[model samples]
Target: MDKLMPQIESHIDFFLREKLPKSMPMVAMLIGDKTIGQIKEVFVSEISVLFPQLIGQYADGLLEDDRLYPMLTEKLQSAAVYSYISGTQSKLKGLFSKVKWGALVFGLIYGLLIGLIAA
Candidate 1:
């Protein structure tokens, strides 16, 4: 267990630094796609009542996808998202360090208690 700490920290650091940044674009795209879909669904019914069926579908495709997808993707990939992720990663690192120390202390105390009980 003592020898495992460095390995665990290294892997977690790698993931937070490397994999997360690389995956952000895809995550943004997915979020944009989902948001646009939901928005289109919400408005499409009202639009259909106001227009022909074909026109309504065309409006749905054009209005939401063309505008909202890029907007959402941009928003998701903006500085705020990255900053939030950075903040969370730092917090997680701090929490992990605390947990590591806590576990060590708990293990020592547990062992000492067991030894004293046996004696």
Candidate 2:
């Protein structure tokens, strides 16, 4: 098992870097719970399909090892939080653009009204 641990860690690193984003939407579904079982379930049910060989090889270590599970959950949660923040930032940008345009229009109208009154 010691010999396999490094290999398992390397594989997990690759999975997080390469496949996690692609599977993020599905992984996000399991974000509420931070347990090893939930993390394992998400990986097994969703992420495994994307990289069967990697999951198959390391699934046991990922689920059963105390050290590995926390690492995996931390990575998963960070990804989910990043995705949520990015989505919110995008929405806020859109809203800010609209508000900016509205303010410009309001200013133009107010200026025109003032000009008419002055005239």
Candidate 3:
């Protein structure tokens, strides 16, 4: 685990710096201060859950090579990206819905005002 710390930290840094922004711009914007905190939380949570089992498997020679490390990183990245993208999509949908309602309300008010003036 100690041996893996540096690499894991680097991966986390890379994901936060490069991947998260490109993948989920809305979430990043919505939670500007909390973005890094949320990402680090996810990273720690995932690593804590998986690292022990992974290390055990490596020690038992169950894993063929160090391929699992990269695989694990990819899995973590994918999970984060998926989570953020879903959240962003939901936010966007809600925003669009609100805009639609606002337009409808504005249109109705404008039509009523015109009708009153024309009368």
Quality of model 3 by C-alpha lDDT: 0.83
Q: lDDT values of the candidates?
A: 0.69, 0.70, 0.83
Q: Can you list the residue pairs that collide in candidate 2?
A: none
Off by over 4 Å in 3: 58-119
lDDT of 3 by residue, 49-103 (tens): 7999988887778466678789988898789787898899999999999999999
Please say which candidate is ahead in TM-score: 1 or 3.
Answer: 3
- Order of all candidates by TM-score, from best down to worst? 3, 1, 2
**Stretches of candidate 2 exceeding 4 Å from the true structure:** 1-77
* Candidate number of the best lDDT: 3
Candidate 1 C-alpha lDDT tens digits along 22-112: 7886654455445645644555444445546667789788787767888877888886878899899999999999999999999999999
Q: Arrange candidates by lDDT, descending.
A: 3, 2, 1
After best superposition, candidate 1 residue 2: deviation in angstroms?
56
Return the clash pairs for model 1, or none.
Answer: none
